[model samples]
Target chain A: MVNTILIMAGVLMALGILLALFRFILGPDVTDRAIAFDVMTVSSISVIALIAYFAGRVIYLDVALVYGLLSFLSVVVIGRYIERGL
Target chain B: MEIRETVGAAVTLLGSVFIFLGGLGIVRMPDLFNRIQAGTKASTLGTILSLLGLAIMNEAWIWKLLVIIFFVLITNPISSNVISRAAHFRGTRMTNKTVADLLSDKNKKISEE
Candidate 1:
């Protein structure tokens, strides 16, 4: 039952990632793309968490933590560049 | 134990659905700020719920999941705010239905000073 649910969650998240990717590629403006990228990162974090649960690895939580931080930093940097002349 | 696993999995599945809706919002929203708002709000909740579900499934990692949840909640909105502000400053065109220009006056004041 647990495996079945995890597989279902994985499929749903994969579909979400595909939508995010579509936005990222077809976005008219850089900010639109950035927004899509942000969504993608968050979804990926959830995916990582689900994967960890499936694998029964506590260590993967640490990976999720780092990835979340990196995603935040990347978004901030992108925002700064877009706001200014960078 | 079986009941706990089933409940956790159900919660996780719901969270994933929210995340999918957020992604859909990003693709369908009319403007940059709208997309940012949709993506940030929905995904934050989605991620938190999924993490909480995972914590429930694995009792030992509850503390670590709590920490991750804290980081996600803190950073998600801040990044979204930064992005929206950037888009505003960069003069990304707004949709026709936009109702307010609260930031325009502030931007003028800043430029004047």
Candidate 2:
């Protein structure tokens, strides 16, 4: 049962990533792309956590933590650049 | 097979669905700010839900999971707020259906003075 649920989750998350990528590719402005990137990274964090549960590894949680931190920083930097050409 | 695993799987599944909806909103929203609102709100909840589910499944790792949740709860809103403010200040146009824009109006008034 757990395996089946995990498979379903993987499929859903993949579809989510695909949709976010579509937005990223077709986004008219840089801000649009930045938000798209933000959505994608957040979803990926969930996917990674699910994968860690599936594989029975504790280390991957740490990876997810670092990924969240960097993604947040990237979004902030992009916002600053958009605001004032930084 | 245990009760905990079943509950955890259910929660994770719910979270993934939310994540999918966030992506859909990003694609379908009319403008940048709308997209940002949708994407940020939904994905933040989704991430929290999934992480909570994972923590439940592995009781020993609850502390680390809570830390991740705390970081997400703090950073997601701050980053989105920053981006939206930047977008507004940079003069990103709103949709036609937008009812009011006090900030832009105030900016215009100040410039007029």
What digit string (tens of lDDT, one per residue) describes model 2 on residues A1-86? 87788678778878888999999999988888988999999899888888788788889989999999999999999999888887
Residue B107, model 1: lDDT of 82
Return the lDDT, model 2, position A54: 73
What are the runs in model 1 whose C-alpha is more than 4 Å off?
B105-113
Model 2 residue B10 CA deviation in Å: 0.2
Model 1, position B69: C-alpha lDDT score: 93
As a whole number from 0 to 100, the lDDT of residue A1 in candidate 1 is 81
| Lowest summed lDDT window (length 10), candidate 1 chain B | B31-40
- Estimate every model's Cα lDDT from 0 to 1: 0.88, 0.88
Superposed by TM-score, candidate 1 places the C-alpha of residue A60 at a distance from the truth, in angstroms, of 1.3
lDDT of each residue in B86-105, candidate 2, tens digit only? 88988887889899999999
Model 2 chain A scores worst on lDDT over the 10 consecutive residues at A1-10
